[model samples]
Target: MNRRHFLMGLAATMATARLSFASTGLIAPINIPLWKGPPPGGGGPEGRVIQSHSGALRNITVPGLSILLPSSPIGHGVLIAAGGGYKQIQDGKEALPAARWLIARGYTAYILHYRLPGEGWHDGNQVALQDAQRALRIIRQREKQVSVLGFSAGGHLLGMAATRPDYRAYTPQDAIDELPASADRTALIYPIITLEKPYTHTSTHRILVGPHATASEEAAWSVQHYVSSQTPPCFIVQAKDDPRSDPHNSLIMYDACQKHGVPVEMHRYPTGGHGFGMGKTGTETVEWPGEYKKWLQQSNAGG
Candidate 1:
């Protein structure tokens, strides 16, 4: 059978063989605050509140991380950042499913509830990146290898972390800052990769760089410009028909990776639109998780 059919068959088999979280034999996740006390430069909207928008959490004041260990350990970890157009956190649609998928594959997964850029936070532009860096450092202490996975605006954050791991969003205030924040590999799904006009996600850019952003600031946040030989290997997924985020976002990043000789792979499906997650029952996008699994295996073998 062809690859698509094979993956569909596998999905059917897995569906029938799937086990519940209680029966999976995995340990429950431990939710940990990113900071020991109030986060640095913390002049955001007072008090942490859970406001919902379109059934997702928004207006986050306190950022944190949660660690879920796999039943069968592989000594690898993934930090997952859910996309919300930089306005909310899509934990239900993006983060949790991704974590469960990774855990079943024997890799520990950390789900990050990063601060939103427009949420009245001090230096809001940097808060999400700071939380991401802090989480990476913490995960590094336990896992020998750690990768980053992000969707939409979260993907933008992952790209920034991968390219500019040395850039500190906040001054060192503790021992965790001493650890490296770099990711070994990255996976971006329908990411917002650039701040440039036309291809850029306009609302995301406004929230991140502001409406009157300077040319220099725009260039600084445009992640593709920071790509170098040191940037981590990446696996990108997108759909040609995604109206929310242009497929060029993934294309430009892929081009830059190739230019810098950073190992990269990109899969673009014809349909599935934007934010389809692991794809529908019988679509081509369903093959992405399987492909990523193979890629990780190859990476482990030094391929």
Candidate 2:
């Protein structure tokens, strides 16, 4: 390894070394549904396990947040959305690990088990957004500053929330919906940013919009196009070799953020592939969680 590359790797390693995998003797997570009665959907036998072993959920009739409060909070909250390509919510591999990572760093974390769009929900494309918006609103009720992190398709959903602050997925069910759905800062880890041709995640795109989805429909869902000056600061991570979501997605998002003058930073690792979750052990991809910590501090996003 050359001097610069070695230094970069060493720096990333040192930065992430403080945050370990040890679950901080976690407090019982509060699993509260987004709605009291029924959600704005038509699906039953909810909470079906699609990946039987992964504990990824499907057809979520009762979408909700699994709240994890750190023993010592930094007075900010992170709402996490783990991607499952619109078919299942990958709680096992993504959300839970991420929540533990955040809470260990003294941040309250909420893992959103949002509904899948194709699971019989009316106006299905809007199902995930509604649940995500609701989860953000609920967190905002207790915390002053709340940020967000989305992985894979969850990144697409949270991307919508970050860009579309005024979109109403469903009629306001209560005052909880009054809170702003906007994020203080947004973090996307190997996210699926676009529904456009040749760039979209195949499973996510096929499930949310059919094979015959129109250009306008595709445009409407692309987060890069929605980035405005009003969009919050963004931090992005993607490995060039990512085979699933495509590293180009982050490039598109970074380009839009830059064009719009939104505060943005992107770290494109040469390797590490996709869905490394908290990152693959002993690899530079594991550096992101550390880099993210430094970003929260530098951006003062931990407020």
Candidate 3:
């Protein structure tokens, strides 16, 4: 181990500790889904599971709880996706803090308990989009506005949902069918927007597509290509040195948004490795959420 690598590991560990503290009494328990049949054709399972699906047209319950902000029509609501690299939703560090962060800014926040791999409910990516689109529609029906935010694989999922020209995740009922074409804004914190070339998370790619999926199938899901002029205003934050998620992930998305003339703002911090949600540690990365908040205020997006 070299000096720099050792320090980087130490920094990551310290951030994790801060998360354990700042995140205390916040994250509710997650009810992990269990599968009964063969996993998805790839490396996933393929069978039925015993659990109440959030149902076809209602707010699906994941392992966590929702925290509603006290303000009325804060003008924005966010669907929060906690990252587990598409394997498990990290209820503690990722989901709860993110929800609370938005709530503090007077935005209604819904924590998504997306389907996990081998859970026998639905494909992880499909389940995540269904949850997000459902949340957007539910919030919009009541208030007519909302936004979407994600971190890591959750970030990737949101990117996929935002750029998709159609909704094929599930059957369309009035609620699901009537979903708006796009969110008002999207905040991607170290998102995995592209699986095509420069910065793919191989482990995550395998989990999402399974080992057997063709290269084309894997390529089809890459979020970078999904970006068009229709993409909503976006905010991105990244750690340039993050090993798990290459900084190029954010850079590629930024370039795509620019190419299409979509509004975008990105901040690339020199530190703060992967999974360092909400800048838990006293490291410089803690400033990202604050920076986003300022951008929101400037855009009149403040609550």
Error of 2 at 154 (Å): 0.6
Pairs of residues clashing in candidate 3: 37-46, 37-47, 38-45, 38-46, 39-44, 39-45, 39-46, 40-44, 40-45, 43-211
lDDT of 2 at 197: 87
lDDT of each: 0.79, 0.79, 0.63
- Tens digit per residue, CA lDDT, model 2, 86-108: 88877778888898888888888
Question: How far does residue 25 in candidate 3 sit from its true spot (Å)?
Answer: 4.8
Give the TM-scores of the predictions, in the order they appear: 0.88, 0.88, 0.75
Better of 1 and 3 by TM-score: 1
Question: Could you tell which candidate, 2 or 3, scores higher by lDDT?
Answer: 2
Regions more than 4 Å wrong, model 3: 1-67, 71-73, 122-125, 198-201, 298-303
The global Cα lDDT (0 to 1) of model 2 is 0.79
lDDT for predicted candidate 1 compared with the true structure: 0.79
